[model samples]
Target: MEGRQLQQVLNTQRLKSLQEWMQESSITLTQVNGQRKYGGPPPGWQGPVPGPGCEVFISQIPRDVYEDRLIPLFQSIGTIYEFRLMMNFSGQNRGFAYAKYGDPLTASTAVMTLHHYRLPEGGCLTVRKSTEKRQLRLGDLPTSINQLELLTVLRMLSDGVEEVLLKMAGPKGREVVALVNYSSHYAASMAKKVLAQAFKKHYGISITVKWTSFSKSKHVSETGQEDGTFTPPGLSPLPKPSITPPHLHPKPSLQDVPAHPPLQSFFRAVGSPAGLPRDEMKPQGPVNRDAVSLLQWMCEVNRLGTPRYEVRFHHASSDGFLCFSYEVLIPCFLIPLYGVIQILPGPSVQATKEEVYRAVAELVIQTICKVSNARPF
Candidate 1:
């Protein structure tokens, strides 16, 4: 009876242990699956948590690096939302730029991969997440400046002009606040200085230039209220020449020739009595169709399919020593059989017709075998 009691006690303990283990296992599984529910990292993750902001600041840019050359480098890593080179008022690159990626992950990737990367033109890039926002504005312009004049000034200021916004503050649209968007901040900075100088020289007023936040300019563009105010004209027309030049002589025309004889006869009538040499006037002979037919027959007999090819035979001397060259399309898979069959004389003489045919047949068979064995990559 005691032994039966002990066995029962042992059975209960075993059951209790099993239940506890199952409960613990269930809790472990729940904890693991609930990780994402609380916005935790996924399983097997091994990297820094992605940061905010898609804009990256790039410093130490080469002076010659323009938008066309700069965008491609970062674009290879991810989609580029914005590329801007920082420039000075003199239309010179300030050796820095900003690139905004479509996502923070992409921006992070570009920073990690390209930071301290050496540029082709001679500078190592200093790439990092941008903390400060950039704004590009050209303020305090002559109110009378039209869109055409603004464009002209901007063009002379720098290249890579993406968008131009002109806000007329005063009456008669005389005081213009020009918002210029360049591919790079470098370009914008350069335009500011040059434009100020140009405005002072052209209009005799000290133009005020300001670099505002990008958000302000972007908002003005997206609203579309000022877009149609002034349609910027095409490139400024070239300046006219100072002096008029003499008229050029008209070229002689074939239609003006006399109707009695054709142009060829007219030329002959005016030339020496003796005509061109016989060799010079003679036309080339027709291709030897017989040789082509023979080669085609051989190819067909050898089970070589109808491949696009050209064959030409030349008979140099009266000795009937014929030399021929041919080109045929061979599938890439059969390239291994390229030199399998080459026609050659037994000792030193030229290859005979039969020998050439035999060689071609052997080449075709080898090519077929190679193609049959080839496997797609």
Candidate 2:
């Protein structure tokens, strides 16, 4: 019995040494792989084949699902390194889970086979690759805010927002919340700081930033669906037009106002105005005193149009351009031709202002050209 115990001890020590060696070698090999990829494994996995590191994400899961029900189903594709189903405060399945696999090939195989596989529950599952990059979600916001207001506040946070998943907390028990997913954690952190400061000043609400993940439970209240942002309100549902309707909402009439360049003319070959009269294309007066009201219509158009343009500012006089810091052109009818693009507006500014104007014109023209091809705006 003593000799047997001694042999067992020796075997344990040998296994420990092998594990330590493998760990060290794996680190070294990872370093040598040029950071982007690995050159196989130095010693490689001890199994019959090599494995690649990959993570899989699953969504649309039924509420009754549990980890036990998933393990067997996932094991058929490849060995699972880790499995996690996001949970809510009630510890219920959030209807989404992430599984890390030993190899990308195996992960791919699993995704292909099980993307629409029906579970014992009523819903089917959707599977895809997991992103190491986190999507930021801001929660605990006051429910009164709208998406435009939310986006304005968040833009103060960071310029790195590739996309944002924004939400307003539901009424009743629902909290006003916003989720801002940035391209990087560093970006997310900076956004939290900037938005916190801006929100306090603008909305008088204290904003909390969180690395947002989906709530585990799929069940949501009707108000939650409306307010929580799982399904954002339709474009028309935004705040109604505040502008008093134009005494006569300008119709596309040639008799009253200049004929609009035909949509076809604008989209035709470069520099081609089709056959629209040039004199008619000139400014039709300073967009009327109802200019302020016209802005609301522009905003509405932006909301409904693809490649939307948010109205940032309006410039009436050239002095307002400098005093109000409206450095850019008015960007509406008549202003581009009569205001900014007009020759010798002022010699007081920089001599290179002409060059700057040319560059800006090029950029604006390119943008218009590209946007014109889109559905609208």
Candidate 3:
């Protein structure tokens, strides 16, 4: 047993060691691939080298489309090494993305096949090999404009805003420089035109908007530039509408009771007076006449004084007594039955004619049993 246990422990240790070795090798392989990709392919790496051909730019993506949706769509053509859907800080899709496939051939095939492909949800895709070495950036935005306002203004004019970076240009951080990353080149251009016009008209200042090449070394400024030269244009304020007074109606007197008297009488009849016995109030026979009459009246009122239920007394052979069966129009009888049961104690009675019949039968049985038990032997 000791030898067997030792052997099992050794096996477990070996398995763990193998797993660790595999993980380390994977990390090393990934590092090698990264070096080759960013730097250059290693010595003796054969055949037409994989360049930007392995990466494809997809545009006109719907706002709802995310990385998960894009993966399945492109997986048919190639294995995705990297899938990224650019999103703003608010987590909204920027409507464009870059997907890098495992091989250049696969990437090229995907580009050709998916280009101008109409999505079921809406929008035709514009797929192509990404040639633009730098991401498009918009500059010369008002420093006074915050990220939210900038996004709103850009969205009003363009399709979507991917990112926004603020910086201070002049000495002592006096000038604010806002850099915005738009999804597509066309969207960026459109925003530039629209915003330039808007600023010129609203603020009476010419806002310079231009695209900048992507740079890894370029870091977004942490602090905003406080420049008094130009103030950001605010949204046009609207005048608040005046509130209207609600119409009031006079309370009806007791003499006007005929209109709504049935409902009031239905509730009053179901409830017992202070001196009344609770047990005697059970629906056994003519003892609960008030309750029965009120319930019937309520049903009549509901059906416009028409009888909506058929009440029949069945003779029970075993008990030698009559059992009541109520066949009622479900909708018409339920409203009053609900009010009748509310005044009674114990479990809540169901709003059904059959339920009412069952309750009445059970009450009769209990009353009979109580009287029989009360008699002397």
Candidate 4:
């Protein structure tokens, strides 16, 4: 068929161009784990390690497209500190990559200028800020493992192992766990995929890896701030940070959520759905959303699991209304989005909790909308 022949011809041309670039030494190519790293701190590049917000997450890449085209496109915005193209074993991109610019300004420019930019093959790319977490919580190690020995073995097994801190985790602190700090987010992503399996295959030991809810640098003492309030490790006192827990399910269900803990609005009095005043239940502005379905679709598209929330109903304010705040965290997403919502709860505590759930669900749909097109309900 003509289409088959045309595809072959295109592949041939791409292969030829890649070969020429290699021979000319215009780009460096190597394999790290399963990725075909195109240029890391590219050739003749004299620049310090890129700072936070310098990298952008790129998705929906066409499989056949290579760095032969992507690098130059991004270079138009600013200097590319590093670019990594994820690849499949069969010699095509896995349809996503990461690009870190020389500075946050340049990276922001690239996201604005190039997101949804159409490729020659007719697929639009999704580009956004990449999340950076330097530390990974590694669990299920041998009890007798020593810090120095474990550190050395980890350096051999994982790329960019800056250092490892050992602590006891499971079952009365009988298991050894390691907190691994990587030099870059790219390194952590790469290591997360393999550390467990690598440990099993090579060392005959098994382990588990997780993204720590709070980075080591962010962890604080019980008496954290100058204010006398005792801020919990992951959650702030009020109107600030809230602790979120990741789900363990590989494919989480929308209905598979935590028990509904009813919440109340501290500052405003809202009656139950049957008797609550209409003004309190509805927002002043026009609103529309099919939150439950959209959340399920989003989870499917981005490879995320069902979200888990940390809801708290606080003591009543002086105005005689109960207080409430909720934190929603969806597992398996690179982006750690924090959703904020302010809405009147229904009269009873249960109605308020449901209203809060829907509000936060819409917030999630809005937050991820830039990274994903809203599919029709």
Q: Which candidate is the best by TM-score?
A: 4
Model 2's C-alpha root-mean-square deviation from the true structure amounts to 22.2
Candidate 1 vs candidate 2: which has greater lDDT? 1
Reference-based TM-score, model 1: 0.27
User: lDDT score of model 2?
Assistant: 0.42
Model 3: weakest 10-residue lDDT segment is 219-228
Query: Each model's TM-score, in the order given?
Result: 0.27, 0.28, 0.26, 0.50
Root-mean-square deviation per candidate: 32.1, 22.2, 33.0, 24.3
| Alpha-carbon lDDT of model 4 | 0.59
Arranged by lDDT with the best first, the candidates are 4, 1, 3, 2
Question: Residue 67 CA error for candidate 3 (Å)?
Answer: 1.9
For each candidate in the order shown, give its overall lDDT on alpha carbons: 0.44, 0.42, 0.43, 0.59
Candidate 4 structure quality by residue, lDDT tens digits, 1-377: 97686566457677677778667756777776556775555655544446677988788887788887887788889888788777766677777777888899899999999999999867999888876556677777666555544544454455555556677655575766677776666666666777776656544566797656433333111111111112223222222221222111122112221122112221122123555654354332111234643564456434465455665555556755545565666667755556345565466444555565666667767777766675424
Worst 10 residues of 4 by lDDT: 220-229
- Per-residue lDDT for 257-340 in model 2, tens only? 223322222222113255865434422222332332233223333452111122212233554332111122332433331122
TM-score of 4: 0.50
- If ranked by TM-score, best first, what sequence of candidates would result? 4, 2, 1, 3
What lDDT tens digits, residue by residue, belong to model 1 across residues 295-332?
Answer: 33333333443333333343334554445454444323
- Top candidate when judged by lDDT against the true structure: 4
Worst 10 residues of 2 by lDDT: 219-228
Worst 10 residues of 1 by lDDT: 30-39
